[model samples]
Target chain A: MSDKSSSRSSGFDRRAFMAGAGIALVPLTARAAVQDPTQAAAQDPALPVEVTLRVNGQDKRLRIDARTTVLDALREHMGLTGSKKGCDHGQCGACTVLIGDRRVVSCLTLALAAEGQEITTIEGLATGDRLHPMQQAFIDNDAFQCGYCTPGQIMSAVACVKEGHAGSDEDIREYMSGNICRCAAYPNIVAAVKQAAPDIMKG
Target chain B: MRSFLYQRATDPGMAVQALSAAAAANNPLTQAAAQPLAGGTTLIDLMKLDVMRPAAIVDINPLARGWSGIETGGEKLRLGALAKMSDVAAHADIQRHYPVIANSLRLAASAQLRNMATLGGNVMQRTRCSYFRDTSYDNCNKRIPGSGCAAMDGVNRMHAVLGTSDQCIATYPGDFAQALIALDATVEITGKSGTRSMPFAQLHKAPGNTPDIETTLQPGELISAFSIPRRWPRSVYLKARDRQSYEFALSSAAIALDVQDGMIRDARVALGGVATVPWRAREAESLLKGQKFDDGLARRAADAAFADAKGRQHNSFKISLGKRLVARALQQASTMEV
Candidate 1:
C-alpha cells in the first residue's frame, strides 16, 4: 500500500515537472508580460489582422496577431497540429509546409504573407482513409523510430520526388537535407523516398 | 516578436514611402524602426530573438511579380533582387555561364530556406555571431552600440579574420555576396527619390568603430536588382564548412578567371567567411593577371589575399584555411571546362 502511494506521488511529480519544463521554453520576460493583463493590452499590436489562408484545400479565415506565423496559425487556431514546431526559428525543418507547390519553412513565414497561397500541411497529404504513397512507403521501409520528424520528412520527401530530386540517393539526400531527422533514420528514409518516387511521379 | 503594423507594398514607390514614414531613419539599418520584409528568414528570426525590434514591417513581396526575374541576355546577366535563391541556383544559364553564382547559392542553407529566401535578403543577412543574435549577451556592439564585445574573449570560432575592427570581429556569413563581388556585380537601388546603381562591392561596410551601421544604403533604399557584366564561364565558388551541407562556411573562395590562350587576361578573387564584408582580394587578382598559371603563382596570390588577415584566439584557423581555399579555387577555375 505504501509502495503504490509513493509510485502515484512520483508519477504526479513527473507530470508536473514536464509541464513546468514546457512552460520554461518561453522567456521569463514574455511570460511575465503575458500574465499581466494591463501590460499585455498595452503591448499588443495595433489590431489582430484578419487573414484567410487556403490551407490543405480549405480556406481558414482567422483574425490573429499580425506577428503570428503560418506554423502558429495552423497549429493553434486551425487545430492542424500535424506541422510540428521543433524549433520556432528556421533552423529546424519540422515546420515545413508546401506553399503554392514550393516547400518552405512555415515558422519564418508570416501568416499575413501567406494569405493567398495554397498551403499544404502534413494533415492534408492523404485522400479520405487512404494514406499517401509516401506515408505507406515510410511504414514499409521502417523509416522512423520516434515519429516526431516523420511528418516533416514525409512532406519534404513528397516535394523532393515532385521536384525531380529523387532520381538518386545522393539527390534525395541533398534535396531533403532541409528536414533533419533527429532519430538518424536516414538510410531507411532514403529507401522510403526511393520506393515512393516512381509512384508519386507517375501521378 | 514585437508587433506594430504590417503593410503590403505593391509598387516600389509605395514601399519606399512606407519605409520612409517610420521614425528613427538615422538609426542603423538593423535598428531601423521600419524594415522591408522579403523572405522573412532573417528579419523574423532576429525579431523573435529581440535582437531587432522594427516597429513597422513593409511586405515587399507583393513587388516580386516585377522584381523576380532572371535575364541572361546581351552583355549583362540581370538578376532581379526578389528572385528566389533556389530559382536562381537552379537556372540553367546561371549554372553554365556563372557556376560561382549557381554553386554559391546551391551550397547555402537548405532547399526549404533557399526557396523562401530572396537574393536581396541573402546579401543583407546579418552575421551568425552568438553575441549579436542572443540578447542575453549585452556586450555586443552590433546589437547595442558602445557595449563591449563578448565574442572578443568568448568562443569565437566563427568570427572574422579580415576587415575586422577593435569594436567587432563578426564574420559576414553569406556565400552569394562573395560571387557577386568577385564578378563585379552592380546593385540597383530604388528609393523615394529614384533608382540608383552602385558596385556591389561598395554595398557592405566593414565592422569599424560603428559596427551597428552595416550597409551603405540610405533610409528607405531597397535593392531592386543586380547586374553582372560579361559572362564568367570559368568561375567557381568553393566552401569549406563544419558540415557537408546546411551550414555556413568556415572559409570559402570565389574565383573568376579570364584566360586568353595560355595566359591569364584578368582574374577576380573574393574571400568569404573570413571577412567582415564581401572581401575582394585585389592584390591576389593583380598577382594573377598577365601571369601564367602555376603552383608558385597560385601560392603568391593566396599569400597576398591573407597578408593583412588578423585572427582572434579561436578563429585563427580561418587565416590558413582561407589561404588554401584561394589557391585551390584558382587551380579549379583555371582547369575547369567552361
Candidate 2:
C-alpha cells in the first residue's frame, strides 16, 4: 500500500511539474502567438500580405496587413524594437533602416513593398557582443542625450560614410539632417558620424 | 488605417487590367477604391492620417525589372517610372548633362526618403498643404469638393501664389517636376487602351474650378517613363527654403540656357513653391531670350515671371521671394561652365 501510495505521489509530482512548466511558458507562447503573422492571418482574413523579409541575416516570413509599415513590422511583429517610432510620419527619421546598401525611412515603407529585400536595423548593427563602429562612435562621442534618434542616426551615418558624403563637417550635417535630434544633439551627432566615417568606409 | 486588398503584379498590363476590373465594379470617380502603390511614402502617409482611404492597392514593384532603368540613349534621356529618386539623381550622365535635374532631386525630401521614393511617385505627389493633410479641418476643397477652401483665409503661408483659383490654393510641392517642365520632358503613360505620351507640363492640371482633379491620368493608366529630348549642360536649380536641407522649398527655380557668343539662343524656366502647378514661366523665358544675361535683364525677367501673380494675405512674401529666385537662377544658369 505504501509503494502504491508513493507511486501515486510521484505521478502527482510529475503532473505538478508539467503545470508549472506550462505556466512558465505562458508569456513566451503569448508573444509568439501575437507576433506570428501566420497565426494572426489564420484568426483574421483581413490581413493577406505574406511578406518574406531577409532581416539582418534571417529570412522572416510574415503575413501582415498590406498597410503595415516596415517600421511596425520590425518593431511590433519581428520583436526588434531597436528602431523607434518617433513621428510615424516620414518627417522623423528615427525609424531609418538599411535596405540592401541604401538607407530608407522605414515608417513610410510598406512591409509588402519590402518583401524579399535585405533589411538592417539598429539591432543588426552589433556582431555578437561587439558593437558596430558607428554605434561605438556614437557612444564614444556621446552623440545623443535622450538616445531616441541614435539608431536612425547610426544607420544614416553608415550610409552617409559609404556614399562618400562625410568628407566635411558641413556635408555630414547636411546629409544627416533627415534624422532630427529633438534633444538638439546636432554637434555631437556630427562628431560621432565623422569619427566613424574612416572605419566604415574601409569596410 | 482601414483594411484593404493587396495584389502584386508580375506584368504591367495585368496590373492595369486589375485596376480597370476593380474600378469597373465600383465608381472610380466617387470611390478611390484601387490605387497603384509605388513608393508608399505619400499614399500610406495620407492613409494613416485618415485623409486618403483606399480599399485596394496594386503593388507595381514587380514591374521594376523593365521599368526601373535609367537610360541615356537615342539623343534623349529615358527615366523609368519605378527608378528611385536618389538613383536618378546620382546617375553620372544625368548629373553631367542635366544639372538642374540632378539638383532638383538632390534638394527634394531627405536622403532616406529619396532612396525610397520613385520618380513617378515624386511627380504624382500631392500638395503638402496642411489643411488637406490634417483631417481636423473640414473645408479643404481638394479633399472634399465644394467644401470650400480653408486655406483661402486660414494659415496660407505655404500656399501657392500663382496659378491658384478660388477653389484651392495648394502648392505643387515637388522640385523634380519643375526641372521636368523647364526641360520640356514628355511623360510616357500606359493604360487599358495603349501607350500615350504627353508633355510633362500637361501632366499636372492647375487648380481651376475643379481643384480635386489634380492629374489628367485615367483610372487604370500608369506613368511608364519620362523622356527628356535633349540635354541642358548649362543649367542650375536654386531653391530658397526655410532651412538649407531636408525641407520643402519656399521659392525654387530650375533654369537651362543655350548661349552662343554671349547671346542667349534658348532658355527654359520653371518655378516651384509659388505656383499651384509645376509652372513653366514662359513669360520669364521670353524676357530672357535674345537679351544679355545682366542683373538688369534678369530683374526685368523676374518681374515678368510674377506679372500676374496674385498672392493671398500670408503668402504675399512668396511673390518677392519667387522673383529673386528667378533672377538668381538666371544668373547662375548663364554663368554655368558647360
Best by DockQ, which number? 1
> On residues A1-203, what C-alpha lDDT tens digit does candidate 2 reach at each position?
00111222443454477677674312111112122222332332242446678899899987655567888889878999999888888888999999999999998888877877899999899999999999999999999999988899899999999988999999898889899998999999889988998998888
Could you give the C-alpha RMSD of every candidate to the true structure, in order shown? Answer: 7.8, 10.5
Name model 1 segments beyond 4 Å from true. Answer: A1-46
Total clashing pairs in model 2? 0
Write the residue-wise lDDT of candidate 1 on B90-155 in tens digits. 999999999999999999999899999999999999999988988878899998999989999999
Model 1 has a DockQ score of 0.25
Q: Taking the tens digit of each residue's C-alpha lDDT, what string does model 2 give over B1-338? A: 66556666778887787666566453333235667888888887777777777666777888889999999865689999999999998889999999999999988999899988899989999899999988789998888888999999999999998999989999999999999999999999989988999999899988798888888887888999999999899999999999889999899999999999999989998999999999998998898788777899899889998999998889999999999989998988888888
For model 1 the local lDDT of residue A173 reads 88
Candidates in order have lDDT scores of 0.87, 0.84
